[model samples]
Target: MDPQTEGHTGLGDWTPEALGAGRVLPVVSAPEAVLSRDGAEVDPIADETVRLAADLVATMRVSPGCVGLAAPQVGVGARVFAVDVTGHAKAVTVHGTFVLCNARVVEASRWKVGREGCMSVPDLTGDVKRASRLVVEGALPGSGQVVRLTTDGFEARALQHEIDHCAGLLFLDRVAGAHAIYQRKVYL
Candidate 1:
Protein backbone atom coordinates (compact mmCIF):
# COMPACT_ATOMS: atom_id res chain seq x y z
CA MET A 1 0.00 0.00 0.00
CA ASP A 2 1.76 3.09 -1.24
CA PRO A 3 1.09 5.90 1.24
CA GLN A 4 0.65 8.64 -1.35
CA THR A 5 -2.46 7.55 -3.32
CA GLU A 6 -4.22 5.63 -0.59
CA GLY A 7 -7.88 6.39 0.20
CA HIS A 8 -8.91 9.03 2.70
CA THR A 9 -8.40 6.38 5.39
CA GLY A 10 -4.87 5.68 4.27
CA LEU A 11 -1.99 7.96 5.10
CA GLY A 12 -0.63 9.81 2.08
CA ASP A 13 2.77 11.30 1.33
CA TRP A 14 4.11 10.70 4.82
CA THR A 15 7.73 9.93 5.61
CA PRO A 16 9.39 9.32 8.99
CA GLU A 17 11.65 12.29 8.50
CA ALA A 18 8.63 14.53 7.94
CA LEU A 19 7.09 13.43 11.21
CA GLY A 20 10.26 14.40 13.04
CA ALA A 21 10.28 17.69 11.09
CA GLY A 22 6.68 18.54 12.00
CA ARG A 23 4.72 18.37 8.71
CA VAL A 24 1.01 18.86 8.14
CA LEU A 25 -1.59 16.05 8.50
CA PRO A 26 -4.14 14.86 5.93
CA VAL A 27 -7.80 14.84 6.96
CA VAL A 28 -9.89 11.63 6.77
CA SER A 29 -13.57 10.89 6.09
CA ALA A 30 -16.16 8.80 7.95
CA PRO A 31 -16.53 5.95 5.49
CA GLU A 32 -12.84 5.09 5.76
CA ALA A 33 -13.57 3.20 9.02
CA VAL A 34 -10.24 4.26 10.58
CA LEU A 35 -12.07 6.96 12.45
CA SER A 36 -14.15 6.38 15.53
CA ARG A 37 -16.66 8.95 16.77
CA ASP A 38 -15.84 7.98 20.31
CA GLY A 39 -14.58 11.17 21.90
CA ALA A 40 -12.13 10.31 24.72
CA GLU A 41 -11.51 6.61 24.84
CA VAL A 42 -7.98 5.21 24.97
CA ASP A 43 -8.66 2.81 22.15
CA PRO A 44 -6.12 2.53 19.36
CA ILE A 45 -6.23 5.04 16.47
CA ALA A 46 -6.83 3.87 12.92
CA ASP A 47 -3.76 3.37 10.72
CA GLU A 48 -5.04 6.27 8.59
CA THR A 49 -4.63 8.85 11.37
CA VAL A 50 -1.13 7.69 12.19
CA ARG A 51 -0.02 7.68 8.57
CA LEU A 52 -1.85 10.93 7.70
CA ALA A 53 -0.15 12.96 10.41
CA ALA A 54 3.19 11.80 9.12
CA ASP A 55 2.29 12.82 5.57
CA LEU A 56 0.98 16.14 6.84
CA VAL A 57 4.41 16.90 8.27
CA ALA A 58 6.07 16.05 4.99
CA THR A 59 3.70 18.34 3.05
CA MET A 60 4.03 21.18 5.56
CA ARG A 61 7.79 20.95 5.52
CA VAL A 62 7.81 21.84 1.82
CA SER A 63 5.12 24.49 2.10
CA PRO A 64 6.28 28.06 2.74
CA GLY A 65 4.53 28.73 6.05
CA CYS A 66 2.24 26.09 7.52
CA VAL A 67 1.81 25.95 11.30
CA GLY A 68 -0.92 23.35 11.58
CA LEU A 69 -2.79 20.55 9.77
CA ALA A 70 -6.14 18.86 10.36
CA ALA A 71 -7.76 15.54 9.45
CA PRO A 72 -10.88 16.87 7.71
CA GLN A 73 -8.72 18.56 5.06
CA VAL A 74 -7.74 15.06 3.92
CA GLY A 75 -11.45 14.00 3.90
CA VAL A 76 -11.31 11.96 7.10
CA GLY A 77 -13.55 12.51 10.12
CA ALA A 78 -11.20 11.23 12.79
CA ARG A 79 -10.36 13.18 15.95
CA VAL A 80 -6.70 13.60 15.04
CA PHE A 81 -4.43 16.61 14.36
CA ALA A 82 -0.85 18.00 14.18
CA VAL A 83 0.84 21.41 14.59
CA ASP A 84 4.30 22.98 14.52
CA VAL A 85 4.52 26.77 14.89
CA THR A 86 8.26 27.04 14.45
CA GLY A 87 8.38 29.24 11.37
CA HIS A 88 10.34 28.06 8.34
CA ALA A 89 14.15 28.29 8.47
CA LYS A 90 14.07 30.11 11.75
CA ALA A 91 16.50 28.91 14.40
CA VAL A 92 14.17 28.93 17.34
CA THR A 93 14.52 26.72 20.34
CA VAL A 94 10.77 26.54 20.98
CA HIS A 95 9.63 23.95 18.45
CA GLY A 96 7.67 20.71 18.38
CA THR A 97 5.09 18.88 16.23
CA PHE A 98 2.17 17.57 18.25
CA VAL A 99 0.04 14.55 17.30
CA LEU A 100 -3.37 14.67 18.95
CA CYS A 101 -6.26 12.25 19.43
CA ASN A 102 -9.71 12.82 20.93
CA ALA A 103 -8.59 16.37 21.57
CA ARG A 104 -10.88 19.10 22.88
CA VAL A 105 -10.71 22.84 23.42
CA VAL A 106 -10.97 23.20 27.13
CA GLU A 107 -10.59 26.97 27.04
CA ALA A 108 -10.43 29.71 24.42
CA SER A 109 -10.01 33.46 24.43
CA ARG A 110 -12.64 35.89 23.15
CA TRP A 111 -13.11 35.91 19.38
CA LYS A 112 -9.92 37.12 17.76
CA VAL A 113 -10.15 35.85 14.24
CA GLY A 114 -6.99 35.70 12.16
CA ARG A 115 -6.22 35.06 8.51
CA GLU A 116 -6.64 31.34 7.85
CA GLY A 117 -6.36 28.75 5.01
CA CYS A 118 -6.69 25.00 4.53
CA MET A 119 -4.92 22.36 2.41
CA SER A 120 -8.30 21.02 1.25
CA VAL A 121 -9.85 24.42 0.47
CA PRO A 122 -6.70 25.96 -0.96
CA ASP A 123 -8.41 28.29 -3.41
CA LEU A 124 -9.41 31.05 -0.96
CA THR A 125 -8.01 32.32 2.32
CA GLY A 126 -9.89 34.51 4.74
CA ASP A 127 -10.05 36.08 8.17
CA VAL A 128 -11.96 33.92 10.59
CA LYS A 129 -13.02 34.21 14.23
CA ARG A 130 -11.02 32.18 16.74
CA ALA A 131 -9.90 32.43 20.29
CA SER A 132 -6.91 34.65 20.75
CA ARG A 133 -5.48 31.85 22.87
CA LEU A 134 -6.56 28.36 23.77
CA VAL A 135 -6.11 25.65 26.37
CA VAL A 136 -6.46 22.33 24.61
CA GLU A 137 -6.66 18.96 26.38
CA GLY A 138 -6.02 15.67 24.60
CA ALA A 139 -4.35 12.30 24.80
CA LEU A 140 -0.91 11.95 23.26
CA PRO A 141 -0.07 8.83 21.32
CA GLY A 142 2.04 6.06 22.98
CA SER A 143 2.80 7.97 26.14
CA GLY A 144 -0.92 8.30 26.86
CA GLN A 145 -0.06 11.69 28.22
CA VAL A 146 -3.28 13.61 28.87
CA VAL A 147 -1.62 16.85 27.91
CA ARG A 148 -3.08 20.32 28.18
CA LEU A 149 -1.55 22.95 25.97
CA THR A 150 -1.98 26.71 26.34
CA THR A 151 -0.94 28.47 23.20
CA ASP A 152 -1.39 31.87 21.48
CA GLY A 153 -0.20 33.89 18.51
CA PHE A 154 0.27 32.13 15.16
CA GLU A 155 0.62 28.78 16.85
CA ALA A 156 -2.66 29.21 18.69
CA ARG A 157 -4.52 30.22 15.56
CA ALA A 158 -3.16 27.26 13.65
CA LEU A 159 -3.99 24.82 16.42
CA GLN A 160 -7.56 26.12 16.60
CA HIS A 161 -7.95 25.70 12.84
CA GLU A 162 -6.66 22.13 12.78
CA ILE A 163 -8.64 21.20 15.88
CA ASP A 164 -11.76 22.60 14.24
CA HIS A 165 -11.31 20.12 11.43
CA CYS A 166 -11.33 17.27 13.93
CA ALA A 167 -14.78 18.47 14.98
CA GLY A 168 -15.96 18.51 11.33
CA LEU A 169 -15.78 22.31 11.07
CA LEU A 170 -13.89 24.24 8.43
CA PHE A 171 -12.52 27.80 8.42
CA LEU A 172 -15.18 28.67 5.82
CA ASP A 173 -17.82 28.04 8.47
CA ARG A 174 -16.32 30.78 10.63
CA VAL A 175 -15.60 33.31 7.91
CA ALA A 176 -16.81 36.79 8.88
CA GLY A 177 -18.51 36.86 5.48
CA ALA A 178 -17.73 37.12 1.78
CA HIS A 179 -16.31 40.55 2.50
CA ALA A 180 -13.49 38.99 4.51
CA ILE A 181 -12.54 36.30 1.97
CA TYR A 182 -9.84 36.90 -0.63
CA GLN A 183 -7.54 35.00 -2.98
CA ARG A 184 -3.80 34.76 -2.64
CA LYS A 185 -2.23 37.44 -4.82
CA VAL A 186 0.82 35.19 -5.28
CA TYR A 187 1.46 31.58 -4.34
CA LEU A 188 4.13 32.44 -1.80
Candidate 2:
Protein backbone atom coordinates (compact mmCIF):
# COMPACT_ATOMS: atom_id res chain seq x y z
CA MET A 1 0.00 0.00 0.00
CA ASP A 2 1.19 3.50 -0.67
CA PRO A 3 2.02 5.25 2.57
CA GLN A 4 0.01 8.29 1.55
CA THR A 5 -2.93 6.26 0.30
CA GLU A 6 -2.94 3.95 3.31
CA GLY A 7 -4.65 6.20 5.81
CA HIS A 8 -6.48 8.66 3.60
CA THR A 9 -8.24 9.28 0.30
CA GLY A 10 -5.73 10.20 -2.38
CA LEU A 11 -3.10 8.54 -4.54
CA GLY A 12 -0.05 9.11 -2.44
CA ASP A 13 3.14 7.63 -3.81
CA TRP A 14 1.23 5.26 -6.05
CA THR A 15 1.94 4.75 -9.71
CA PRO A 16 1.37 2.24 -12.52
CA GLU A 17 5.01 1.49 -13.28
CA ALA A 18 4.52 -2.22 -12.67
CA LEU A 19 2.72 -2.45 -15.98
CA GLY A 20 5.77 -1.43 -17.95
CA ALA A 21 6.47 -0.53 -21.54
CA GLY A 22 2.96 -0.04 -22.84
CA ARG A 23 2.24 -0.15 -26.56
CA VAL A 24 -0.28 2.23 -28.13
CA LEU A 25 -3.25 0.26 -29.40
CA PRO A 26 -5.79 1.25 -32.02
CA VAL A 27 -8.82 3.07 -30.58
CA VAL A 28 -12.20 1.68 -31.54
CA SER A 29 -14.92 4.04 -32.75
CA ALA A 30 -18.58 4.42 -31.82
CA PRO A 31 -21.27 1.83 -32.59
CA GLU A 32 -18.72 -0.84 -31.94
CA ALA A 33 -20.35 -3.68 -30.01
CA VAL A 34 -17.72 -3.65 -27.27
CA LEU A 35 -18.47 -0.03 -26.33
CA SER A 36 -22.11 -0.90 -25.85
CA ARG A 37 -21.50 -4.06 -23.85
CA ASP A 38 -20.71 -3.85 -20.16
CA GLY A 39 -17.15 -4.80 -19.42
CA ALA A 40 -16.25 -7.84 -17.35
CA GLU A 41 -14.41 -7.63 -14.07
CA VAL A 42 -10.92 -9.03 -14.14
CA ASP A 43 -8.20 -10.15 -11.76
CA PRO A 44 -6.21 -6.96 -11.30
CA ILE A 45 -2.84 -8.65 -11.05
CA ALA A 46 -3.31 -10.98 -13.97
CA ASP A 47 -0.82 -10.54 -16.81
CA GLU A 48 -3.51 -9.80 -19.35
CA THR A 49 -5.02 -7.17 -17.06
CA VAL A 50 -1.67 -5.51 -16.56
CA ARG A 51 -1.02 -5.55 -20.27
CA LEU A 52 -4.36 -3.93 -20.94
CA ALA A 53 -3.69 -1.25 -18.35
CA ALA A 54 -0.40 -0.43 -19.99
CA ASP A 55 -1.95 -0.27 -23.41
CA LEU A 56 -4.68 2.07 -22.17
CA VAL A 57 -2.09 4.49 -20.79
CA ALA A 58 -0.07 4.32 -23.97
CA THR A 59 -3.06 4.97 -26.18
CA MET A 60 -4.36 7.84 -24.06
CA ARG A 61 -0.96 9.51 -24.26
CA VAL A 62 -0.93 9.54 -28.04
CA SER A 63 -4.51 10.58 -28.65
CA PRO A 64 -4.83 14.35 -28.92
CA GLY A 65 -6.81 15.97 -26.12
CA CYS A 66 -7.42 12.49 -24.76
CA VAL A 67 -6.99 12.69 -21.01
CA GLY A 68 -8.81 9.46 -20.36
CA LEU A 69 -9.22 6.11 -22.12
CA ALA A 70 -11.03 2.94 -21.13
CA ALA A 71 -10.45 -0.69 -22.08
CA PRO A 72 -13.59 -1.00 -24.16
CA GLN A 73 -12.43 2.01 -26.16
CA VAL A 74 -9.57 -0.18 -27.24
CA GLY A 75 -11.91 -3.12 -27.96
CA VAL A 76 -11.33 -4.90 -24.63
CA GLY A 77 -14.33 -6.08 -22.67
CA ALA A 78 -12.79 -5.36 -19.26
CA ARG A 79 -13.32 -2.80 -16.54
CA VAL A 80 -10.06 -0.93 -16.83
CA PHE A 81 -9.27 2.68 -17.64
CA ALA A 82 -6.38 5.15 -17.75
CA VAL A 83 -6.51 8.83 -16.83
CA ASP A 84 -4.12 11.80 -17.04
CA VAL A 85 -5.51 15.29 -16.62
CA THR A 86 -2.07 16.78 -16.20
CA GLY A 87 -2.44 19.74 -18.50
CA HIS A 88 -6.13 20.14 -19.14
CA ALA A 89 -7.41 23.68 -18.55
CA LYS A 90 -10.47 22.46 -16.71
CA ALA A 91 -8.54 20.15 -14.41
CA VAL A 92 -8.30 21.45 -10.89
CA THR A 93 -7.01 18.32 -9.18
CA VAL A 94 -4.51 16.50 -11.36
CA HIS A 95 -3.41 12.93 -10.77
CA GLY A 96 -0.60 12.90 -13.29
CA THR A 97 -1.23 9.49 -14.91
CA PHE A 98 -2.82 6.40 -13.45
CA VAL A 99 -4.79 3.30 -14.31
CA LEU A 100 -7.53 1.66 -12.31
CA CYS A 101 -9.22 -1.70 -12.57
CA ASN A 102 -12.92 -2.25 -11.95
CA ALA A 103 -13.33 1.30 -10.66
CA ARG A 104 -16.63 2.63 -9.37
CA VAL A 105 -17.80 5.83 -7.78
CA VAL A 106 -18.15 5.54 -4.03
CA GLU A 107 -19.36 9.10 -3.56
CA ALA A 108 -20.33 11.94 -5.82
CA SER A 109 -21.44 15.50 -5.18
CA ARG A 110 -21.32 19.03 -6.57
CA TRP A 111 -23.32 18.28 -9.63
CA LYS A 112 -22.48 20.35 -12.68
CA VAL A 113 -22.84 20.22 -16.42
CA GLY A 114 -19.79 20.07 -18.63
CA ARG A 115 -18.86 19.52 -22.23
CA GLU A 116 -17.57 16.08 -23.13
CA GLY A 117 -16.19 14.45 -26.26
CA CYS A 118 -15.13 10.91 -26.99
CA MET A 119 -12.64 9.22 -29.25
CA SER A 120 -15.37 6.83 -30.26
CA VAL A 121 -17.91 9.54 -31.01
CA PRO A 122 -15.46 11.70 -32.91
CA ASP A 123 -17.79 13.97 -34.79
CA LEU A 124 -19.77 15.26 -31.85
CA THR A 125 -19.57 16.80 -28.42
CA GLY A 126 -22.26 16.95 -25.81
CA ASP A 127 -23.16 18.58 -22.55
CA VAL A 128 -23.53 16.06 -19.74
CA LYS A 129 -24.31 16.48 -16.09
CA ARG A 130 -21.70 14.94 -13.80
CA ALA A 131 -20.36 15.33 -10.33
CA SER A 132 -17.66 17.92 -9.91
CA ARG A 133 -16.42 16.26 -6.77
CA LEU A 134 -16.00 12.50 -6.58
CA VAL A 135 -14.63 9.66 -4.58
CA VAL A 136 -13.64 6.45 -6.32
CA GLU A 137 -12.24 3.08 -5.33
CA GLY A 138 -10.44 0.52 -7.44
CA ALA A 139 -7.48 -1.80 -7.55
CA LEU A 140 -4.24 -1.01 -9.27
CA PRO A 141 -3.71 -3.40 -12.15
CA GLY A 142 -0.25 -4.84 -11.47
CA SER A 143 -0.18 -4.85 -7.70
CA GLY A 144 -3.86 -5.54 -7.12
CA GLN A 145 -3.75 -3.07 -4.29
CA VAL A 146 -7.02 -1.32 -3.66
CA VAL A 147 -6.97 2.46 -3.33
CA ARG A 148 -9.37 5.30 -2.74
CA LEU A 149 -9.21 8.63 -4.51
CA THR A 150 -10.94 11.91 -3.80
CA THR A 151 -10.79 14.39 -6.62
CA ASP A 152 -12.62 17.40 -8.04
CA GLY A 153 -12.92 19.28 -11.30
CA PHE A 154 -11.72 17.88 -14.58
CA GLU A 155 -9.90 14.93 -13.12
CA ALA A 156 -13.09 13.85 -11.46
CA ARG A 157 -15.00 14.34 -14.66
CA ALA A 158 -12.49 12.24 -16.56
CA LEU A 159 -12.80 9.45 -14.03
CA GLN A 160 -16.57 9.51 -14.29
CA HIS A 161 -16.36 9.44 -18.07
CA GLU A 162 -14.15 6.34 -18.13
CA ILE A 163 -16.23 4.62 -15.47
CA ASP A 164 -19.30 5.25 -17.59
CA HIS A 165 -17.54 3.72 -20.56
CA CYS A 166 -16.89 0.57 -18.56
CA ALA A 167 -20.57 0.48 -17.73
CA GLY A 168 -21.58 0.53 -21.41
CA LEU A 169 -22.48 4.22 -21.53
CA LEU A 170 -21.43 7.07 -23.74
CA PHE A 171 -21.74 10.79 -23.06
CA LEU A 172 -24.45 10.71 -25.67
CA ASP A 173 -26.33 8.36 -23.40
CA ARG A 174 -26.30 11.01 -20.69
CA VAL A 175 -27.13 14.11 -22.69
CA ALA A 176 -30.44 15.93 -22.22
CA GLY A 177 -31.52 15.55 -25.88
CA ALA A 178 -30.42 16.15 -29.44
CA HIS A 179 -30.35 19.84 -28.58
CA ALA A 180 -27.52 19.18 -26.13
CA ILE A 181 -25.21 17.68 -28.72
CA TYR A 182 -23.02 19.72 -31.02
CA GLN A 183 -21.05 19.09 -34.17
CA ARG A 184 -17.30 19.24 -33.66
CA LYS A 185 -15.62 22.30 -35.14
CA VAL A 186 -12.01 21.63 -34.20
CA TYR A 187 -9.73 18.62 -34.33
CA LEU A 188 -6.85 18.04 -31.98
Query: How large is the C-alpha RMSD of every model relative to the true structure?
Result: 9.8, 2.3
Q: Per-residue error at 75 for model 2, in Å?
A: 0.2
Model 2: per-residue lDDT, tens digit, 48-141? 9999998898888889899999999999999999999998888888888999999999999999999999999999999999999999999888
Summing lDDT over every window of 10 consecutive residues in candidate 1, give the lowest-scoring window: 5-14
Segments in model 2 whose C-alpha atoms lie over 4 Å from true places: 1-7
Q: Over 4 Å off in model 1, which ranges?
A: 1-49, 88-95
lDDT of 1: 0.59
* Residue-level lDDT tens digits of model 1 in 1-188: 12432232212233235334444445443333333222223332445445655666666566656666655555555566667776534323223666666777878886776777766566678899887767776655433345566666666677777777666566776897899998956643
Model 2, 68: alpha-carbon shift in Å?
0.2
Best by TM-score: 2
Task: Please list the C-alpha lDDT of all candidates, in the order they appear.
Answer: 0.59, 0.90
